[model samples]
Target chain A: MSEKIDFSHVRFLVVDTNRLMCQLVKDILMMLGCTQVTTARDSEKAIANLRAGGYDVLITEWNLKPRSGLELLDWMRTDGGSPDRMMPVIMLTANSEVEYVMESRDKGVTEFLAKPFTADGMYRRLVSVIARPRDFVSVKGYFGPDRRRQQIPFEGPDRRQQKPE
Target chain B: MRNKPQFIPNRGELKRKAVNYKTGMEIKLDEATLKKMEQLVENSSAEFLSETVASLKGLREALGRAATEPSARKEVLDHIREEAFQIKGMGGVFGYPLLTEFSKSLHDFLKELEDLDELQQEIVSIHVDTLYVVVSHKIKGSGGPLEAQLRASLKAAVDKAKPGTKPAQ
Candidate 1:
């Protein structure tokens, strides 16, 4: 595969209730050559940062005090004040389960990375959200990155292909 | 929901800003770069050890208070669950999988029980104590046979304590 990434301009917001997690992620980001990294312990603080704008990506843990990361993702997708509904979010948490993955996906999370995450894994996610941004979907209830990852060929009579409203 | 899933093209602001075809910066992390990142995490191992020790101390004290004070049990249990969860996420990150394993079990157990019974409190206490031992000795990896058995035994004790209900994950 080809490699094309530059973290010099990408601003990051990491949300986790644990000070250790926040520090670890920030350290990893710095190691990856990112200088503009902000830390938020709860969803509320995360929102304040998000509203200020300029954050290119969000990395949050699932278990947060007062408000969960899922709730933060929900607000980003659905809240009117959210500057970027299509903002890429990476859910990095210890809640490693199929159910959690599916739940985060439904909540419009761009990526789901379980904890005990490697720096390599974290870097890969950053590359994806930055270098290869995913197309978004906006429907009645949900508004964020499109959840469907694969595009299987449909050998059927009528297949609709158009930019949705 | 819309009639069809709309595919809103990403304006590629991030891509434009972060990717420079001129510089051709390879997003892939090389071995040396990866090593540097690993060292960054490993460098914090000492911090993890000391902080975890203090955290477990808090967990133990909270457990003791929950045992003696009936009124504090509700709030204390919530705090323990949150603390255990933080521990669960950190241990494996700092080369202490056993710490994660035990605390994850503790966290899940706390999730299952709204209020701790006498047996429940004892089992939770054991979980807290085991966590203390793991971090205190700087036990890394998943641990040996005895440690594995201790994890299994904790699960068994939870099953026995709860009887009919399955433990939360």
Candidate 2:
């Protein structure tokens, strides 16, 4: 793992309603050498900024005013909301329940960071998006990163490699 | 050879417009900077907890009012639930992981308020009392035997109040 990330030019858009939480995120990014950071207090404003373009990544809370972050992700992936549909998104929330994790994974989220996250935890997610970008899967009812992080050896035939009839 | 017109593109102007894009990255934080940011986060969390304690006091007052006035029960319970939700979400972030756990239990109890009989309401009151103690003491992390005992008693009461709802642990 190289310790030479240059976030000086990577633009980020942070969407969170809580002022304190937003400032904490901004400070963390700034400390990481990110200079181009934009913030939106709600989903509507986030959409407007996304449409304006030039953002490299997005960090959003699960709960937001007017629209939830899940809802925003839905629009971004399905409704052609973002100019770059492959843009990486990290979903933040206090709820670490399995249901919420599954929901976010199904909704095309690039990464999920639970609330009360440490600086190291956040840094790992950022590195994941930039260093190890996941391939997008557009199968039935799913249109996001491949949910499987590990590949298991199989004795059976490889279905993924089978040619279409 | 005849001297051709000299052409010099403004180097400074080109430098200003050049975009420096680099991907496949890793963040490296110096020890001093990391320590400073951690301290800032801690300070902010302490301030947040102080403010939260004041809010909790207000919630306790609202609970008292609800217990006394039947007409205000619904509204007061709603307010308590809202506050409990906030506590559940923020407690872990502010270094009070135990408070987050307790508040989650309280939030669940509040959700089933309408189904609770008088005995069940009493169980909820016990939970409220325990939360007050936990927050006032500024308890953090996994509390010791005392906290365990508090949780066990509350669970027993809840089981007595609403049998068959919770599976035996």
Candidate 3:
């Protein structure tokens, strides 16, 4: 699977305040054949870059200076500040608590990678976002990728049931 | 309800156009480049670890000052927590899972130090000292019995200091 996916043309934007972490993420992306990887030290710069458009993916740390990655995500998904609201976003964080994961999921994160992650783990996430692209669903108070990954056949009557006339 | 036309004349054309547009934008990975990347990640660990050690040393010095300076305690503790947070994130990546665990404990402990009492200050000092030992010694893998012993002692001290409260695990 790693061999088949070509990241040479994919443009990535990495957002993190830590210089070393940014360098590490950049190196990993460049190693995966990504030629253009732009990085921002904080959410403001990242948002400005996103507004300019052309990035195919965004990798951001959960904690950023002044504003958090979640706040940035919320702005992108709902504020109409972004050129592409459905852009693939991968969140990086050290907090592996279930609450954090759930919060990111609910906020419309495409993928979540816990820190101290391996190269293979990062690659897998890249592949998951690119190869298995999920359809975005936008309804009242909800807008993002389909949360459900597995589909089961429904043989019975319409389970939703018709609304009262 | 009236029956509607099942077919839309431009639907197939739209689908075909979408496919043609996507075919030109497909991403391709170069095998050679990926192999180079794997090697780079392997080689970068040592450099990363050394940098981490330097950062930890700086944090230790700050922690020492924060312990004694009451006026600057709040600001210094915040800085220490931020540094510890970074260590927590990168420690496991550089082959020091125990460092990550201990740093996380330290970060959590620092967060709960709003009203730094003398005993709380001592506990913070212990965490900083222990972290310095762990990072400087390059303690990889589990610390085994020694790790357990350290944790037990720290926990006992913290419990004694606070009373009716468990220390960060």
Candidate 4:
């Protein structure tokens, strides 16, 4: 049986240097019936809040003060002091190019929401993280959600032999 | 260091805690909620405009100081790039695509520059000025033909501003 997703209890930590952007995101989250939303202005403050705990997801910007959001995400995913490595991250920023998306994906971002985004877009991403979580993958020099999105079918015996890492 | 690959399934605590029987299974965006979000942005339009104006001022000031303050030029350029990047992001959301497009040029120009030359500084000034025009007039979306011409001119300026950038064919 399928399950219903609710947002009223999920805690969120939004990090952005821009006041308006942060407020806008907070307002949108509130509109979606999310009761617990917090905002931080920079990566440093974000890290502090994360360390303090109680956040289920992080929606951050690409540009931040003192340190960029990518740096914060790196720390979250790889740092020994990371609060929750599995916390979903949505990289929302003006960096909407393919390269930026690829970089964020490689860094373990759960979703990428480019700036000029719509309310529906934000809602969709939130639902995705809550309802469609990906399995985590850890390997040498990498740890993140599974990078592969598709599964291809191969008929007959396996064509390649592989040694386990 | 270990090379073993490990797969960990997501713990469904978030989902379990958020699940409700009355809400149903099929997920969909509520139109009324979206409308409310739009209204919220609309309510903040005035604030966005003022903040954008302030951002433009910040860009102009940083660019201005980069010329007079040699010792602080690097710091100033970094500030300008950050402010420009911010404008490039906010303008579109607040209904000023032209401003975003214009400042994107400024951001790109300074993105790789450790130091700026005379011509590059001029290019930065030009972009900041263009952003001012857009913010002041509240030019929404892509502007008219004149704005298009301005965009093309800025593109050419960015390309030629570099020492060895090839001319577009």
TM-score leader = 1
Q: Could you tell which candidate, 2 or 4, scores higher by DockQ?
A: 4
Model 1 per-residue lDDT at B63: 80
Q: Which stretches of candidate 3 lie over 4 Å from their true place?
A: A1-3, A156-165, B1-39, B161-169
lDDT of 4 by residue, A26-140 (tens): 9888877788999999899999999999999999998887788988888899999999998999999998889999999988899999987776777789888888888877787
lDDT of 2 at A151: 75
Model 3 chain B weakest 10-residue run by lDDT: B1-10
Pick out the ten consecutive residues of candidate 4 chain A with the lowest summed lDDT.
Answer: A156-165
TM-score (C-alpha, index-matched) for candidate 4:
0.88
Clashing pairs in 3: A6-B28, A6-B29, A7-B29
TM-score of chain A of each: 0.89, 0.90, 0.90, 0.90
Clashing residue pairs for model 4 = none
TM-score of chain B of 3: 0.66
Candidate 3 to truth, TM: 0.82
In model 2, which regions exceed 4 Å deviation? A1-3, A151-165, B1-34, B64-78, B111-125, B160-169
Q: Which candidate, 1 or 3, has the higher lDDT? A: 1
Query: Which lDDT value does model 1 have at B29?
Result: 71
What's model 4's lDDT at B168? 57
The better candidate by lDDT, 3 or 4, is 4
C-alpha TM-score for every candidate: 0.92, 0.76, 0.82, 0.88
